[model samples]
Target: MLTTKLGVLLSGRGVVAGDRVRDALADAGLTMRSAFTLTQLAAGPVNQQTLIDLLGVDPSAVVTVLNELEGRGLVSRQRDPADRRRHIVVMTADGTRTLHTVEEVLDKTDDDLFAALTPRERDQLERLLTKVADADSCAEKY
Candidate 1:
């Protein structure tokens, strides 16, 4: 189906975009793992388990990435005041700086990738993608 092909193509584009952003971040002395973890933290302080769930990564993988980030002094983990059993992950000032750099990289990647599309086409694509994402989220509630 054409729609299916489009979907696959979009996924491939996403992978390419991610790779480009990763490389840019790496050149800036930031790892893809740390950038991703900090992006999660940017939403707010969250537990390791929640980050694992959101990223769809294994617990061990999440732990390893978090540990590396901690070692880099980009992230800090602390016991949740409300629940000592849970660890809250927060980004440090260094992490925030890295996130800003990552954001710039992602912006450039998006601009380059979508440059082929006209402004109207880009607007339509964004609207359609937003609708699909919203639908998926709504479906999850059922």
Candidate 2:
């Protein structure tokens, strides 16, 4: 019963946070889907295969997402200099701006979500979450 309650609470919080982020992105004149895709590309230069691996999606789906991003001029793809046949994905200036906005929204969401905790409690919570995230079992889930 406790586990079920925790699951429901977590899912509800996730949905609310997602809605906030989507609204924030829309206010910044960007789509939430595009913002997410662009931010992923901004993390580093990645090939389609890398994106597929990171996103846990099929190659064709990733290609479709990349194509949409490219069409919006939010992301650019270039042939890898070392491997001309392979393409590398990079964020454009617009994408960088959108990513910055999204990050701000995420920061605010974090602050709001943890507002009930004292500063020390927040720090402890963060440490515990990070530890769980770095656990072997957690890595396997990813």
Candidate 3:
């Protein structure tokens, strides 16, 4: 018997969608973590510690990601004027362009995932999900 549980269904669908998104991002030469980093900097500069905390990863892992992004000219780290010991991460023009590409890729993935839904249904679903996401403080950055 099929269980009628929204949480279970949503979790399963989320995993599938996540995989699809990861694959699409990979084609654009980005990983989820790297794309997230760029997305965070899209708003403005953030100190390295902020990134590390946002990413919830080892400091070294964040450094590796930063190194790769810097090497690609997507981002740069500059010493913060307020605090010389802290390095602020800023997205470059190239990174902005790449972030746009990432958005397009995610949009495509959304379309693919919601292909079964009618336009109206998609809109309704988005509204409902937005409400849920809005309730979560962490969703603001995402």
Candidate 4:
């Protein structure tokens, strides 16, 4: 009880959240990070450097992820024609279809995770968390 209150109050990392989320995503053969990477590419080709910055992951880690996605035919990395130096990551057609499928599964999984909370309470928590995240953005602006 106290821990749940404190989690909402402090907006700290939910230590077990990742494991649960991973389990939730496993049905789609996706990891949390892999799913996130797909969403990022859904916007369009992401430059390697931009991906590193946006995802806040190490360059080597990004490379490994890109390699894995490429092997799965979920994404492809091609050199930027305009900038020759950076590689742009783009999602494949299969990746798009898979992304939607995973999204549906993840939605259900998210509901399952939050099943302990009433729907109204879930909305309230989401609002509070959004406020906290917005505050974080405001803090970063300075």
Best by TM-score: 3
Q: For residues 30-130, what per-residue lDDT tens digits would candidate 2 score against the true structure?
A: 66556656767877789867777776656786688788778878788999999998899999897787678778877787788778999899899789867
Off by over 4 Å in 3: 53-58, 130-142
lDDT of 4 at 112: 72
Better of 1 and 4 by TM-score: 4
C-alpha RMSD for every candidate = 4.3, 3.5, 3.0, 4.1
Sorting all predicted structures by TM-score, with the top scorer first, yields: 3, 4, 1, 2
TM-score of model 4 vs. true structure? 0.79
Distance from true location, Cα of 37 in model 2, Å? 3.2
lDDT of each: 0.80, 0.75, 0.90, 0.80
Give lDDT tens digits, candidate 1, residues 59-110.
Answer: 8878998898899888899998989998989889988887887898777777
The TM-score, computed over Cα atoms with residue i paired to residue i, of candidate 2 is 0.71
Which residue pairs show collisions in model 2? none
Task: Give Cα distance to truth, residue 71, candidate 2, Å.
Answer: 2.2
lDDT of 4 at 18: 54
lDDT of 3 by residue, 1-142 (tens): 3556877888899899989999999998999889988987888889999988876678998899899999999999999999999999999999999999999999999999999999999999999988987798765342
Model 3's alpha-carbon lDDT is 0.90
| Candidate 2, residue 53: how far the Cα is off, in Å | 1.8
> lDDT tens digits, residues 1-142, model 4?
7767975645444545556667777778887778888888899888889888878777787788778889999999899999998788999998999899988887786687688999899899889977877777544210
